[model samples]
Target: DAPVPSGAKGTYALTIEPLTAIPLYASRTLTSSDPSGFTVQTLPNDRGLVSVPSTSEDLSILQK
Candidate 1:
């Protein structure tokens, strides 16, 4: 997670990986802004994960 400077625009990236079949969710709250505004975001409807095979040599050894 990251914070944007006051009166500045920025972006943040979030990643989640669930080994099980269960669903995953994320949430964040911005207490205050440059002008003292509050914001919040919940990720049940905005977060997801993708699966990829291990192809790196070191990771392949661990898998075996």
Candidate 2:
């Protein structure tokens, strides 16, 4: 299975066990409004035409 891209709205299968044991790096901090660590704001939305930055995160396996 391929991992989904960020800023994508949908359901994803998250293996918590694997995540907890590894180092997961997010492009940005999770807002209080969303706590699932899924929702991410790419760009600042204000005007009609906005340039949204395309951001991506990384996941690495770390040693304890």
Candidate 3:
């Protein structure tokens, strides 16, 4: 996960890459359902990236 920059506040994209090549793969964005302080942005422009507020609590990411 990408760390939020100091005094940085706003929506940002995350970068995602595959460890192994897979056929018929599709891309999409993965946003937080309850974004109280921080959230994730998974778009083509920013895959596997997350947006963080200046002041936020500890966060955990769970992949299905």
Candidate 4:
């Protein structure tokens, strides 16, 4: 594992299977009584945000 110090910058590459979708609240029920329509609806706290910046530079040279 590579650790970067505070105020430092680094570039890294990772290869893995991309995430499709996550099934949330698929295990337990949500309500106390008569959980037919009023099933337990829970929302987890906001974790983080991610985005890929749009670039106009051609990256075909990196393929080979």
Clashing residue pairs, backbone N/CA/C < 3 A, model 1: none
Per-prediction TM-score to the true structure, in the order listed: 0.40, 0.16, 0.23, 0.19
- C-alpha lDDT (0 to 100) for residue 6 of candidate 2: 57
Q: Score each candidate by Cα lDDT.
A: 0.64, 0.44, 0.47, 0.44
Off by over 4 Å in 3: 1-9, 23-42, 45-64
Candidate 2 Cα errors over 4 Å, as ranges: 1-47, 59-64
Q: For residues 19-48, what per-residue lDDT tens digits would candidate 2 score against the true structure? A: 366654333334454554445633322223
Candidate 2, position 27, lDDT? 39
What does the lDDT read for residue 57 in candidate 4? 82
Full candidate order by TM-score, most accurate first: 1, 3, 4, 2
lDDT of 4 by residue, 1-64 (tens): 3333245466733323336666433222333444545444333434445566787988898998
For candidate 2, the 10 contiguous residues with the lowest summed lDDT are 41-50
User: Residues 2-64, candidate 3, lDDT per residue (tens digit)?
Assistant: 445455579755344567776334444344446535544432333345555597565554432
Better of 2 and 4 by TM-score: 4
Highest TM-score among the candidates is held by which one? 1
- Which should have the higher TM-score, number 1 or number 2? 1
- Candidate RMSDs in order: 8.0, 17.3, 13.7, 16.1
